[model samples]
Target chain A: MITSIIINGILIGLIYALLAIGLTVIFGVMRIINMFHGEAVMLGMYAAFVLFDKFGISPYISVFLTAPIFFVLGSIIYKFLIDPIPAREREITSLIITLGISFIFATSAMYIWSADYRTVTLPFSQDVMVFIKTRIGYPALISSCMSAVMIVGFYLFMSKTYMGRAIRATELDKDTASVMGVNVKWISIATFGIGVVLAAMAGGILSPIFYIYPFVGSNFVIKAFTIVVLGGMGSVTGALVGGIILGVAEALASTFLEYSMKDIMAFILFLGILLFKPSGILGGRTRL
Target chain B: MFFKILSSVLFLLLLFSQVSYGAGTFKIGCPAPMTGPGANFGEKFKKAYTMAADEINAKGGVNGTKLELVFEDTQAKPALAVSSAKKLISSDNVIALLGGWSSGVAFAVAPVALDNKTPYLLEHPALDDITRKNNDYVFRLQPTTGMYSAALEDFILKVVYPKEKKKQLTVAYIYVDNAFGQGVAKYGIIPFFKKNKDKFNLVVSESYNENAMDYKPLLLKVKNAAPDIVVLTSYLTDGILLAKQIKEVGLQAKMFTGTGAGHSMQDIYEKSGKATEKYFSSGPWHGEIKDANWKKWRSAWEKKYKYVPGEHEVEGYVAIQVLAEALKGVKSSDVVKQREELKASLKALNMKTIFGTVKFDNFDGYTNQNKAYKMTAVAQWINGKLLQVWPKEAAEREPAY
Candidate 1:
């Protein structure tokens, strides 16, 4: 029973990490806290649902298509919505702007999709593979593995590539990076696009496990924010670790204690981590 | 010149009388969540109201005075429902109010309807307190949550879970924390747990917010508890989400019953895919009602909507049809006069509804009428089709899974 909980916790944690990575990147590089991050995820799910419903595209393939489309969408949002705010007032102004964007996106989504719950069914939707008397969902395996790959790919992209170095430099010191001929505008757009792409990728994978509704983003935003805080704000690795911690805590709480206690567990972990580590498990002094 | 003056005066008097009599248009206001999380129920109410009003109009307009329906979109918010009710009464000049889906929205509009001295013919709001404490102005067409819970409990006890072999009786309850969920918990689930304490063990009980997307934690907890039955008292979106998760987790529960008749929708089956076939729920109305009148109504409604009348649509239609019968029986268009006559007629009514006979007992133009609230045939998804499963007399097919 304990082994199963741990495995389930790890799987759920990995998925949360994947979901939170894009939000963290957007915050770290662009310094814009996107309130619409979850909406981007929901939109990706809807994209997959439309594909499956209309053309019978496999969810796995839909993920690849959705990610790039959402990347461009994120770039467009950054250009139009976030670019207008002055740099000095970007902190407060960006919140309202992104909030406005979130509401607009959510409303437009409702108008287009009609707020109905949609889902994609894969061959493994209900298939359970038992390993040594422990049962795991087949799609859950796909979600976790995909999340891990994305996290690693994200780290490598940030560390090795030229654009990646620019993003990291900007995260470290925006003024310095801009002075070093970084074309900070493009970097911001690229970072925002990557963040949105990650969100979309998570959505595509997670939608099969969770139902798709226009308002689904509302719940995710809360968890994603909690995860960001728990992981240490502005830290990519922190967000990933925070995601896993929260997921595992939730699984454990629901397993031993009451399921209702999971929310309380999240808050407690957030506070405990803040008070004790001050920086998250993998988080450094730099803002995530 | 004197003859001309007399003719002019007579014409003027006739015009004045016509204008005053024309004021008896009798507007019934429909305020529902036409756009929001709870919009499906609202849409059903809207369709049913339109069908009723159109039919009434064709039959010479509700006792010679037209039934003017003014629909206000409240978006399922309490503040909006209140504001919409005020506008409908004060600005739109509606004589009475009719439709609402959520109990919170209904409660918000109820006081407004009362303060304005207008009768509110509540179509589908099912909070117990709405009917229990009693105001004379609020008239609910559907049964309250308490009534539904009680009837459902009785049905389950007498029909589903017989006492002779009461083994494997454990329940896990998950619901949204709003009025709809609370009412089901307070009236339906809590009582069942209380009475059948020896027979049933409640392993898990949790409440989630309305727009909940991730139910994995909840599903995991329920599965760990090892329940033979899972009772979910949630509406549309969450209903499908939770069911999907349950299938994903592979909990081999004998019965998964939802409080509302949500599984009947094509959207649910379409989204849930094969997952829906294992789901069972109770709705107020079933298309396969064996009665001849019900069959006729079902055929016509199916042809028109491309879908059979669900519980909400059927109840909404029945509410209007009963109102029509009452108006016809009383032969009055006066708003105040019709209110009284309709109340009395509804209380004493045993009219055949589209689903079955609607007979209200102690139905005091107020609360807990019809003690005769039907069990509402149990329907299950069979090969993605929602088929009737209970009361073998009416059932078209055997219960699958």
Candidate 2:
């Protein structure tokens, strides 16, 4: 039972990390929390749903379509909404603007889809892998694997690519990077685009396991925020570690205590991190 | 300037024309959650209420007065419901109020209706206290949360228990933590177990917040307990997720049942696919009545909505029909006197609708409660369809268990 709980925790944790990475990336580049992050994920879920419902496409394949579309959407939103704000007030103004954007996204989705809970049930969605007593659903396993691969690919891109280095330089010191010919503005746009694509891909991965709805994004946003804070504000490795810790903690709480205590335990851990380690596990170090 | 003056005059004429049109109509205020989590139920209430109103008007209207339904979006929040109720009563001057979707919203709006002395016909919102508060204006068409599982208990005792090989079966409950879910556990499932203590042992009772994404840890706990029966209470989204997760976690039990709410929805079967097969749900029954009127109404509803009406939609339709029946004899110039007559008519209501025999009675500390309705039915999902399986006469199929 304990082993199963831990395995389930790890599986869910990886997905949580994928969700938080997008939020962290946006924050790292722009120093502004993208409140519309969850809504972007919601749009991706809907995109997957429409593709499946209309064209008989699987969410796994739909991710390819969703990623690029969301990248463009994110870049356009940044250009029109985020980039217009003065740099001094960008943090506060962008927060409010993105919050509004989130509302618009959610309400528009509701208007179009009518608040119905949609699901994509693949033939193998329910198939389970059993090793001794530990059982894992195929969708969860596949999503976790996809999340891990994306995280690794992102990590490699950050460390090895010239654009990735330029984005990191822009994150470190925008003025210095601008003087050094890094094109900070373009880097910021690219970073925001990449961030949104990650969020949308996470949504595509989750479409099979979770119910898709207009407000489904709200269910995950709080947890993603918690993970981003816990892992250190802008650290990719921190998000991965933080997601695992929180997931395990919640699983343990649900196993021993009441099931409802799982979320309470998560919040308690969040508070503990905020109080005891305000910088987070990897806070102050803006590692991709 | 002359065109502006003429347009202003026309606008004033149009406004007065609307006021004159209002004099020939009797309005019922409907406070429903039209755009929030409860919006699904709200949409159903809107459709059902409109259909009933249209039908009444098609038959030369109620007492030759056109029925006008004034709808206000409550968003299923108490604060919004109260405001909507106030607006409906004061501005629209509705003689009666109908359609409270959630219990929290109902609790807030019920008092406003009472204060205004308007008859409030509660279509859904199953908390028992809504009717038990001695609010003279409130009358409910759907069964209270406590009564939701009455038919399920009967099915279990008579059919499931007798067939079980074990001498003492174990039970587990996993429900959403809310008024409706807690009410079912407190007043329904727990009492049944306490009554049949010798035959059943409740191993665990777990409650989780609504719209939670993960149930694997929770289902794992239920799996470890290995209860013979698992009872659940949830809305549509959570219900589908729980069903899927329960299957994913491989929690084997003799039976799994849900007490109304999401489990009773057809979306569960469609969304969860094979995960929900043989799952039983107990609530106000619909879709399988033997009456010709019910058949006609069902067909009409399907033709209009492109889907079969569920328990909530049926309850909404019945509430309107009941209100229309009560409004039939009321003919008075005084608004206060008309409201009083409507209240009295509701108290004395005993009619047959497609849903069931509608009758309100005061019994067991409940005021203006519909105690005579015997329509709570348990249904099971079998072969991608929800079919009534209990109350032998009303059942379309035998219990799959």
Which pairs clash in the backbone of model 2? none
Residue-level lDDT tens digits of model 1 in A134-189: 57778788878888887888888877899888988888888999899998889998
lDDT of 2 by residue, B1-401 (tens): 99999999999999899778777888889998887677787888899999999999999888898899999998788998999999998888889998778888888888998999999998788888899999999998778888988888999999888898679999999888988888888878888898999999999888998877788999998898999999998888889999999988999999999988898888888898668899999987883489998889988999999997778888888888899999986879666788999999988888888877778888999988887336789989898878898899889988888
Worst 10 residues of 1 chain A by lDDT: A279-288
lDDT of 2 by residue, A1-288 (tens): 999999999889999999999998889778989999999889988898899889989988899877888999999999889998999999999999999999999999999999777899888988999966888889888988888888888888888999888988887889999999998888888889999999999999899999887877877889999998899887888888888898888899988998889999999989999999987788866476
Cα RMSD for candidates in order: 5.8, 2.1
Off by over 4 Å in 2: B1-15, B333-337
Report how large a share of the reference interface contacts model 1 reproduces: 0.47
Q: Evaluate residue A38 in candidate 2 and report its C-alpha lDDT on the 0 to 100 scale.
A: 91
Per-residue lDDT tens digits for candidate 1, residues B323-379, read 666555454655556556555665566766664555654444445344435535667
